[model samples]
Target chain A: MKLEKLDPTVKACTSLVCVILLSFQYLVSLNIAVFVLSLLLLLTCTRARGIQVLKLLLPALVAAFGLFVTGYFHGRGTRAEDLQKIAAMPYAVRAAMSTGLYPALQISTRLLAYAGFGLLFALSTDGEAFIFSLMHRCRLSPKFAYGILAAIRLMPNMVREFKSVRLAFRARGMQLRWYSLPPVFTMLVNSIRWSQCVAMAMESKGFDGDAPRTCSIVPKLRWYDLAFFSCWITGILVGMCLLRY
Target chain B: MKWKLKDILMIAVCAVLFGVIFLGATYAGGALYGLLLPLGMPSLGYEPFYGLYFMAVAFAVYVIRKPGVGIVAEILAAVIETLMGNFFGPIIILSGFVQGAGFELIFALTKYKRFDFKTMALAAVICSCVTLGYNLIVSGYDMIALPVLALMLAVRIVSAVVIDAIVTPRLADGLARAGVLGGYAVCEGVAKDLDC
Candidate 1:
């Protein structure tokens, strides 16, 4: 396989992408409608489901609820039956609850939006485009850009193992004790072993050979890519107008 | 030192992995449900937070053993994430710089002599600590009372050690074992035919 799909023709696609990314500056902060649409565009483009988005969203919910719930009890200065105490400062607890809750949610929601866009980029767009975009267009060193591409290819498995660790520990009748240290250790050992096997396999294939790299699956930008960017950016601009009223 | 094609491939791969990690971290830390926990300790899904970033850098250093490898990998990854319009944007890039420094400092401390497993672990821990300290300041985790700050730091540091030293390293090892990373003997790959 070609390491990157760079033939002179792919340049047309890249220029179109440049235009689309330019539009994002406008749509990213417009309003809830534009933002939601952008979110939807990202979601549909990536082909991820609503549930997937929700999974990505779960963290924001947890942080907000956790801090708010804790802060509420902590505010009353009455320790509930099962709640942890938030230091016995007079308004400190309340301040933490009051001041911290919104920020936590805000910060987290913003995180979700970012992740949405990120997941969109990863799921929808070809990884090669982004990698080459950095190297060929953004002036990033090829070494660095390709490294990221390699890692992205390897990432799903990392997520799988991360999930596997959580599952395997649960299956083994392990209880959550002190950050699940024991299970983590077990997972660590296994993962180390996995890395070794994979590394050897790669080398055996002469991947370690001192051959120059070449692009295998280069992406070409299409009208859709351009249209998508325009929609996102213009949506952002329109939202900004609405927010003003 | 001249740049090699192999070096570029490795750096690019690790950089993207960096993005995947942060995406996982933020979701976990900020998630409302599926909160993985110990009896009393909160799992800082963010534990691996910025730590993965530095690992990518360190991995570059470990694999290439070349100057600027760590920083370059990190900066490029941050650029990808930023261009995708990450919420934190370039701020993440800034963190990458400090964390990269943290990784570089470890190699410098070792005088670039040995790239042992334990030494790499030490670097991960130290760099993570640097990130934690900086995160506290930037995110205002430092504004909390002394005890809370201390607790958070302790939790973060320990988690960083475990995740960096054990989980991530081993995962790289496992992939190597599965015959994925066949290029370098930098701990991201298997040490086959060794005197074990």
Candidate 2:
């Protein structure tokens, strides 16, 4: 099934749970399975293009490579005695092949698994749908929910304002560093004013925070959402158990 | 406890702006992490940018001076960052919560009355420690050598204290002095100080 068809909350929860579960274990096979499965599903089922996914995965790949090198040299199991502990484990547990190699593989692969789950949720879920789901399913306050939706709408304009401010500064022959306060101050001042205007406009339109309101676009949960959640969780759990030997 | 529409929008806008910055920092941090890999301390790459992560919390609480503003602002920023296609994905929302709770605890202890530099610095320190503990688990910092871990902690604390604590308050005050934050608590505080 396509992940995009699933509820946003379910996708988010599944990704979070998968990350948490994968963080505690040193099972290389489970991490690889998750990373591969997520990637395959993302490519085949989701609308996310392979190129876009590859671009996003580049950072994860780089980070994983760095972590692998770090973990190999500085990992807790670097000592020879630590190597003995690995050999004593069952056949399935010695998948790392040598001392310090287990953590190197585990951490680097776990990073990939995390990136996979993260990409799965991020690429498939729509922002508006997620906020609506939070409101309808999670009982988020209308004040905050609508506030977020409005902010999302304003994001493009905010970006434009940011650029114009920087350009205006440059026009004055002032080169503002990224860490400079003047540009941020200008932006904050504008933001405060804009926020006031937005608030006034919203209030004028009878947007009451306390009053119960109905949403025209309510995100509903379906049976497949449940199925997807369970399958994702159980698949990882069972995979970990089997890999434990 | 009552939040005006204006207040909520203020938080939302500020969170959105900072969320964009956070996304940029994440990319920069990723690059730095890759560069520092050969140093055997790849985790230190993001420490310098740690202060930027907590700016939403500091900005919101300092200007709004309300209960729970820090947590709300931080989480909202995380949500915005997530929606903007941050590579870290939804897990950041959880990190936001943990990071928010760090400073929120400090502000709550002060009963939301004190907005002094001392209080803000202390809150930043507490926040750094809290996030460090969370990172130890999620990022597996516990696996690294102890000296490297300690260095990372020190750098993060200094970043948090310098930017979120020192720079943010002064920046907000500058905005207030410019007379743009007129309706907010920061403006009100400035007005009262002038009257004195």
Candidate 3:
């Protein structure tokens, strides 16, 4: 399937639903199957694009691993029974520890599932088309919808402006802390001014909220989107039913 | 009142700024979480970073003083973050919607009139509850023991208060004092004093 042809709204809705279902599912095999399937779909859709997905998934994977470890230690197994079992042990080894597989699997798989679905939706869906569909299909107000679109478009320039601002601060013998609030304030004030200019320009060009307007390109659901959605839905249902749970 | 272009632009620009902030915070928080997890102390990536999530939402409300601006600003931030290849993906958007609604509800209940420190703190509490609820549902945090959950909630609330309530109102006021927010709602509240 060509990435551009997929309806953005459909992709978003389908992936969201899949992620929700996968969150509830805890079986390791089922999760691995779903993750594999999602990965395959991603690769199948766009092999080159899948590389980007893999790159983005790294942080999520690390987070998932952390969650798994946290769940293993802090899970419900810390009750009095497990506490006694721990005290009597010669040492706290992996073998001596009570099982945490179920909960840990649940957490990691849920994280992976979220990453999988997130990549699927984000990698394939066009941001502009998604915003357009939000207005046309979801009935978001144009003021807000186009505002978001404008913001999305401003992201690159915003990044550039942030760099330039930081450079100016650095040249002035100022070192900005990564988590410090001062640079954020500077960037925000500057961006607010930029947004004002954009708003003025847009209003001058007659972007009246009360006025009727038409889109240059309208997004409509097509057969491929329906097929894509149904396939995922059926796969999820089957996966749910097959899991022994 | 009909929302003007300036209002929309404020929301958009703020959303972009905060979205970038959020992405950066998530990376830093992720690294911190990675280090802390091995130290046998888990923050779940929320305790340290939770404040960044709601700062923009509260600031947007303070600036716009509109009913749905919190959610609007948050959802736009979520979109921008998604475009920036957020590891949490679109689910962060869902979290954004829920978190923003938490603040929006508080602001709406106050009739969008109260911008005090107490109101912002209370709003942060509500936002923390929403975050906890979402985690319980998706992250299986419900399966954890009560003490751990309480501690996580405590950290989240404290972060939200310190950042969202304290820092954000002051920042918004600072921007207003700088004459940048001349036509916005925050300015209107102090218009007489500032002679706007």
Top candidate when judged by TM-score against the true structure: 2
What's the alpha carbon RMSD for model 3? 4.6
Worst 10 residues of 2 chain A by lDDT: A76-85
lDDT of 3: 0.75
TM-score of chain A of 1: 0.47
Q: What is the lDDT of residue A37 in candidate 2?
A: 93
- What DockQ score does model 3 reach against the true complex? 0.62
Give stretches of model 3 more than 4 Å off: A78-98, A170-183, B39-45, B189-196
Once fitted onto the true fold, the runs of candidate 1 whose alpha carbons sit more than 4 angstroms away are A1-37, A43-52, A55-100, A141-245, B8-54, B73-98, B108-122, B133-146, B162-196
Per-residue CA lDDT of candidate 2, range A145-197, in tens? 77888877887777788788999999999978987767766876787688779
Clashes of each: 57, 0, 0
**Model 3 clash pairs?**
none
Across B20-98, the per-residue lDDT of candidate 3 in tens digits comes to 6666777778777867787444546648678888876898888778888888778867777776667666777788898
Ranked by lDDT from best down, the candidates are 2, 3, 1
Model 1 / residue A127 / CA error / Å: 1.4
For candidate 1, lDDT tens digit of each residue in B1-196? 5655554544544555456556666656655223533222232334535455565676566655666666766676665665443543345566677777877777777777666668777877777678767655444333233454455557666665665656666655544554434555553335653322
Candidate with the greatest lDDT versus the true structure: 2
| Model 2 whole-model lDDT (C-alpha atoms) | 0.81
